[model samples]
Target: MTSFSYGEFAYVYDELMKDVPYDRWVEYAARKLQENGLSAPSILDIGCGTGEVSVRLAKAGYDVTGVDLSDDMLTVAQDKAQGEGVQLSLFQQDMSQLELPSSFDCAVIFCDSLNYLETEDQVKGTFKSVYDHLEPGGLLLFDVHSLYKVNHVFGENTFTYNEEELSYIWSCFQGEHPNSVEHDLTFFVYDERKDAYDRFDELHKQRTYSVDTYKQWLTEAGFSKVETTADFTSDSPTDKAERILFCVQK
Candidate 1:
């Protein structure tokens, strides 16, 4: 199967994601920074698809830099930042091999972006890279799909979305690895000029490990403190939690 790249998918991403709570993510980052005695900290937004969260952080008066693996997505992000009248430094880079000239006070990987990494080594490499780029007392915040979600919610499931301009049929199958899912999506977008629909297909793979595994990786990467929360709240995750959030300090 071909790997997923946000090529044409970048154009419809924002429209499909209108209900995402981007403001809440920014607020969480800001509040965490303030609680840690960091005011107006510089932020590194890893896997910042379409710049939604990055632009919001900039508007919230934080220095924001965005990184993504897809050039098409970064192009959309650049346009969005300009339209929103926000300044953002954006780059196309793999999260596991991150490299930048300056360090940041906080690094965030939101929207379950960390789940896209398909291997244990990639995830560990990403933690090490983020740790290298953080300043002393810096914070690293990220979220991922819980193991239960990967196994029960996405495994061998089918979903569909219908709209006037766009529609998609999404099917999920078990991946080769444990606790992993491979999503096969077929999209049909209306072509108003041609009075027809154009179709495309994409394949995406996502995997999740347990909280203990992630914490061990953070410790191996030299993080000083680590905390976990569930579904955007400050409570510890239960077995049924769909999302798991991690807050680590360097």
Candidate 2:
């Protein structure tokens, strides 16, 4: 399948993404929330890959519920939550069709998870679904890739990173559309215990929606006020990068 499968990679996800600097993201978001006059008692994380943010929010004293499509990701997330001695609720659910009764004080879709929706309708549906799950005054925070990054920066470049047992090659190509990039990736992993090797390939496609377009969608989803900034640092976007975070109040 093109989507991420739990497989053997589940156990090594955190290690592979060790450079992600998740703590930075949490700290940034927390500061932004404090500045915005919002403090959530409970949070629902949409597309919460492996519950990285979910676990962090739980530790920050918020009841957290994380939802993802990959069973393997959820499995790893559950294990991590338990190992950390923190309680986070995680479930396997499609973003377009979420099934949760408890309305959250706040919801988030971080790490460019919004780009995982492949189509325009899917994106709108996800926004509508998240809108429905929020408390009347709750907030929904999400981010998307920017057009500048796709066209000017990542058009066609390759990077490689290596570890003791597994390594990966990353190649980015500009998509035919105006604001999209295709990531062609390959992974080589060796199991020292089994003395065997395995290879896996993944093609990840990410597209950017204009800032105005996203704000309009949030309004259509019944979000009354929408605020945006170019980066997690709470600065406006420039021509250099393609990441923007949108904060919507329901």
Candidate 3:
């Protein structure tokens, strides 16, 4: 079994994530862009897993380019875009070492993807790379798991999901680093032709820092202004907020 996440998991990603509010994310990005005087701007969808948000943004008339480290995820994203009759420039690349050809009007790393960076330096590098690839005055929008969620929600927790075609046992444990968690997922998927269930496992790790630390890093990476919100709303982040969203201007 592959230890890395998003390998075999990519096949079942969309099915398991059907409840995700992809439209809300797209709306938020569009609203922020319009507020910044960018209408129908070019967008870079960093860590665009399976292209769910990327396809939606393209359908909403934004020029979208998606980049992800996983080839399987990118394959799924490309197929999704083709099925939606939308054109997306998809690339396989690491987010921390991004090197695209053209600058973008806006860049986004949503869905707690930033938390996947285990080290502080990697997160800072991602911010700087994004800053370099964005045009002057361009905005960078991203989100991460709050410290509260990492400690209280995911720490040493076990969750199970069941459906007719799929089931999973997910266990989370405290990682070696502060504000980090390791996820061990065991999946049993129904195979129709074989009339049997195939079992596989994957391990994923995520880490996050305090909001102030993130803000300081963004400033260090050349962002002039950084505004934050909580749980997809415009309200300020409270201690109990689960998701912390950041919008920075370069």
In model 3, the worst 10-residue window by lDDT is 1-10
TM-score of predicted structure 3: 0.97
Per-residue error for 147 in candidate 3, Å, reads 0.4
CA lDDT of each prediction against the hidden true structure: 0.92, 0.80, 0.93
Model 3 misplacement above 4 A:
1-5
Q: Which portions of model 2 show Cα errors greater than 4 Å?
A: 1-6
Report each candidate's C-alpha RMSD, comma-separated, in the order given.
1.7, 2.2, 1.3
- Winner on TM-score between 2 and 3 is 3
Summarize candidate 1's per-residue lDDT along 100-133 as a digit string, tens digits. 9899999999999999998999999999999999
Error (Å) of candidate 2 at residue 31 is 2.7
For candidate 2, give the lDDT of residue 24: 66
Spell out the clash pairs found in candidate 3: none
Error of 1 at 70 (Å): 0.6
Backbone steric clashes in candidate 2, count: 1
Candidate 2 residue lDDT tens string, 197-219 = 56777777887778889888888
As a whole number from 0 to 100, the lDDT of residue 222 in candidate 1 is 99
Tell me each candidate's TM-score. Answer: 0.97, 0.92, 0.97
